[model samples]
Target: LDNNKFVETRFGKQLKPSSKSTTYDDVAENYDGQYRFAPIQEAQVSRAMIKRYFETMYDRAISDVVIVGAGSAGLTCAYHLASTRPDLKITIIEANVAPGGGAWLGGQLMTPMVIRKPADRFLQEICVPYEDEGAYVVVKHAALFTSTLLSRVLAMPNVVMMNATAVEDLIIHEDHAGQQRVAGVVTNWTLVALNHDTQSCMDPNTITCPVVVSATGHDGPMGAFSAKRLVSAGLLKELGNMRGLDMNRSEPAIVNNTREVAPGLIMAGMELSEHDGKNRMGPTFGGMIGSGIKAAHEALRVLDS
Candidate 1:
């Protein structure tokens, strides 16, 4: 209670005032009252968000590439595709509220992510810091890599991410060559899709794209969704399903098998593992990264041809 001293709050912690006298009002003004943003009504906020999001959806109704699942492989594929061809419109549909998928955590919910040597080139390309461990590299926090990659991909003008949007089915059609192939995706709100058992029947919408990248993971709640749907649709004979974990074999197989499973439908990431009955690589992300890059190249090739 000294006459010359005044208590101030710094993030809920009390701090002794300096020689210069500071009043409660001064601290309050410096913190809470410093924001000069325009007052916005709740309705206006809703309108703004809806307007922007719907406009984006409408504009990207017909995209060059529609990547299902915004996991590591999908995001990386989008990043490379968008970076390489800014003219190409890319739409990434993610079922979860947040993107990044399992890349946000390493094996068994650990923080550090393991990336083998050659795949570390992608880390260097993205300028993400990592620790060298002989043949492998370690990202201090998995989130660092996922967030950095996500932010960079989303920053591209032609790239759009629709999280909380679930792709229910693939649209199959006959091409001019009389070949039946996946031509688009049927989508619905993730919440609606999740609550389908209790909710009334709601028709899903469709978005057509020349190329579709199925980067959904393996044996997850919604993993390998596109791949499984393709099998059900008769486009693919069957998904061999995923084999047990075997990093050495799985890692190489995943990258090697990243290719077009059906016309216009390219499988990447863990989806490739399940589609080809390959082994699971666990937390090692080298295969995922390599698969994404290869998928992007394949997509570019398809588009160019």
Candidate 2:
């Protein structure tokens, strides 16, 4: 061995020195003896975590369609879009950590979800078992129904399911033709508002999508948020309810009225009632599912055009 060359020994074994130098002092500073592997391993893990986090953020930021509220309507719309248009990126943003808004708890915790005959085929496709009880098909277990739909939607590769996120505002922009269109949404963590932990209103992060679906159900934030923006921009008239004498006409009215209210914005489920003044048919899963399918079709048409 040359006298100028220094070899490092670890646990009675000769270890190869770093490529930079064969001196003990140089290798000691560069490598931590037996713990030399720790730094490299930590670095790899850190890089992986950062890559995963940012990749998800990037995907969400560039989603093609963003549906607020992951209820029956939202999930159905997502599932339909994912099945038909696998190439398009879809994201479902739900305020609650658990998916299936209203479907899980129904009217009360004890109440099971009831879907009419119209939604039977959809229920069967998702493998939700229901018993026909005269006027309605009664779901034996609300949780089971909710889980089945949620699981199916989550299984889609192009569908991103985001829980615990709430849309605070809608992103509106003017197209080349000078038409006002809803471009995306501003969202924040639901816990921030639920806990009231902030001293002032926190600004939310924005997600850009060509199409935005307001499946936020009755009293959803998206409808009111978009309404304010559209009305102010002169794209929409003052939001008002259409006075209908017969409340019984709500079911068909709701299903038929599910459509795009503005450029690049579609309303589904109970949200349709807000736009068209359709009577609120309480807890009718069939109408909600039909509305969602209609909304999904409208969104596809808008995208295609």
Candidate 3:
């Protein structure tokens, strides 16, 4: 969640925690950061905060535990962490319009998920299937091996899911705690949707948590921007001086087997692709889960301190 990746859904598909309006993988690819710009008066991709950058976006005052993508990693992290510590408030902001991000096209659920349990297969290999009733093909990409275990985490009660919500910007402030140290994490999202009728924090509200868990993957809604910013600011020295799409940057699509990016502000996932039994042993899914969990744990550590 570390502010940008994915959360797993019950459909054996990824769900956007805060998104009932968008899909997880779709958001993953759509927000790939290279989705292209409209060239609004000479390609002016504002370096300003995301709130001032794009239109039709929304934000949820997501502090504490706010997951980004609502994919396997995010859901896993949320489930695992929540299982580890049920009291930690967790919120997922998904950009997809529905859960099971990729189960069916007309709302009629599929059987593979309920039958063969494809998630385990997704963790170990790329799945491709064709139907006799159509001329189309379905392809499921690979991810880290632990991805399948994401199931147990989803069933936990501590986990809350939100859909159709996309992150617009992150507000990182430095507040001092009794003159001991400085810290802060208040992320903003774009287009927050929830069930109507008089309810609790079911609407667009600001939530403050001592820790922020972002699971938005490599090319996450905010992770990509954050990485680019770090590079622009020269925080990632080991890779070199660059931003967005640079050789140093590791987008999920760049996975060529099992390579990974370094550990900077964004924990590189592609690095673990070498592990056996993994789908591709690259970053994206695995790195996202590992890094998101690490971020959550680290955030919790910071909170405890």
Best by lDDT, which number? 1
TM-score of 1: 0.87
RMSD of 1: 9.1
Tens digit of per-residue lDDT, candidate 2, span 1-305? 46345443211123346577556665667765532434467788889889976688787898889998888888888878877887899988888787787888555566677887677788877778888888779887778878887777776667887788888778889878987888998888887745546557666798999899888766544334454455677777775543343435776787788888988899887766655666776766788788888888988998898
Q: Pick the candidate with the highest TM-score.
A: 1
Model with the higher lDDT, candidate 1 or 2: 1
Q: Per-residue lDDT tens digits of candidate 3, residues 167-205?
A: 443434443552211122223334433233344553343
Q: What residue runs in model 3 are displaced by over 4 Å at the alpha carbon?
A: 1-63, 98-151, 176-205, 220-225, 229-289
Error of 2 at 256 (Å): 0.9
RMSD in order of candidates: 9.1, 14.0, 17.2
**Alpha-carbon lDDT of model 1:** 0.88
- Per residue, candidate 1 scores C-alpha lDDT tens digits across 1-305 of 46335443211123355667866667668668663446778999899899999999899889999999889999889989988888999999999999998999988989999999799999998889999999999999999999999988987778899989999889999868978988889999998888889967888989999899999898678888987887888877988889998998998899988998898999999988778899998999999899999999999988888
Flag regions of model 2 displaced more than 4 Å. 1-51, 193-201, 220-229, 232-234, 241-248
Per-prediction TM-score: 0.87, 0.76, 0.42
Name the 10 consecutive residues with the lowest summed lDDT in model 1. Answer: 6-15
Could you give me the TM-score of model 2 versus the true structure? 0.76
